[model samples]
Target: MCCLISAGGLNLIQLQKWNQAAVAKLCWDLAHKEDKLWIKWIHTYYIKDQQLGDCVIPQQASWMTKKILASRYIMLQSYLPSPQHQSMIRTFYLQLIGDLPRVQWKCLKFGNKARPKACFVMWLCLQQRLLTADRLLKWDIEASPTCVMCQQDPESHEHLFVTCTVAKTLWAKVLRWSNNQLCIATTWNEFVQWGISSAKGKAQQAQLFKMVFAECTYALWTERNQRLFESTSRHVDQLAKDLAVICTVRVPPGLQTLIHSFQF
Candidate 1:
């Protein structure tokens, strides 16, 4: 059977012959005369395993079958089954936010209109690219992992991007420029959820929020890279300017016109 399947030269008649032989053997093994007869009849017209493993039958397969198969075969071996622990972690993370954005709720891949920043953050986190002061200390990148801008104990994603004084000031400037009023979040999760949930009604406000969020994240990351690589000092003005340029470039012309009109 294996050789017949692997040989690949079987035409319709040959395929039918092979299938009948296989099914007859299976039926004899099963010891069901009716089932054996049914199998023989079925294989008479419908040559089973004609293409064998050469082609995938998309019509007969489920959409998630591949993911399920891969996950079972691959991930199950490496990642232990800890559903309770993972659930606890996810719950703890979600507790920081009042409401989750619809995009996040749906678990859609990042860069969609709904949760672009969430997607980017997920990618960064998965890639281990995010530089926390703890990570810097552990890697011996610096003598201390203390935040340079605030001189705080440790600079984490939450602290450096959202809670640090320099970050706060930069966000303040950005908010002022965009004419938005937002309560500063102390946690990364909270800030993300806020970005997702806030500005639910006004399309303009939502667009501005997305643009500003993307800009701020890019600027903060850029500044961190410069400081880490070149031993350069943090520059809030440059960060702000970079953010402005990012927003200007990303925001659509219609929205830009609306923003300009609002300013006037």
Candidate 2:
């Protein structure tokens, strides 16, 4: 019996269909209904009433196994769980669902580290959802694909945010003011890597860097959109000064010492 249970565990891990063979398979529509699916899984896997002398141990109902089942059911419904059970299940389901997409962004840790609105735009930029002119042209939108900010090279995630002449000016100014001689990165990923490395070790500086980086990206993207849609823009010097002021205002009170470093 122990060997059979071990085999069953291995089969489940391997995603084998052996468990379904233990009982008659239910139809799809009925299987998806939430009210009694738990009961069905229990009966199919643990209650072999049809076979004489077969007894499944109730002790095998482990928390991990139950969590997997609960996650499946909870995700299928849009409505929240009842008030009484909300607190108990909230953290489990949230962590379970939240962890799903994080694997895709393991290399990008800048999200959720700064102001929400700015972080939101930066997140969208990381996901390549900005719909810049270059992207629009790829979708056959029949628009000029040149960088709206520089109006020189074809616009892209890298060019508009990093390599554009205007953008390069902003970064150069910021780096100079901070007394750092590091050159501005040419690509978005490289920029993120540089920011992470530059601010490593000190927690306050790391958070400050994240906020400033996110704000800069947000300002740049907003400037791009306004250029595209509103036909207005800021000069590189004014934009850089605005970035410094924005960063100064957003800096935490405890980290006020470094706030002057951002001001021109």
Best by lDDT: 2
User: Per-residue alpha-carbon lDDT of model 1 for 67-121, expressed as tens digits?
Assistant: 2222222221223235446542223222222142233412112222323554365
Taking the candidates one at a time, how many backbone clashes does each contain? 0, 0
Q: 149-190 in candidate 2: lDDT tens per residue?
A: 887999888887778888887777866665554555877788
| The candidate that achieves the highest TM-score relative to the unseen native structure | 2
What residue runs in model 2 are displaced by over 4 Å at the alpha carbon?
Answer: 1-87, 94-114, 179-181, 199-202, 261-263
- Stretches of candidate 1 exceeding 4 Å from the true structure: 1-129, 136-143, 199-202, 262-264
TM-score of 1: 0.52
Instruction: TM-score each candidate.
Output: 0.52, 0.60
lDDT to native, each model: 0.52, 0.59
Clashing pairs in 1: none
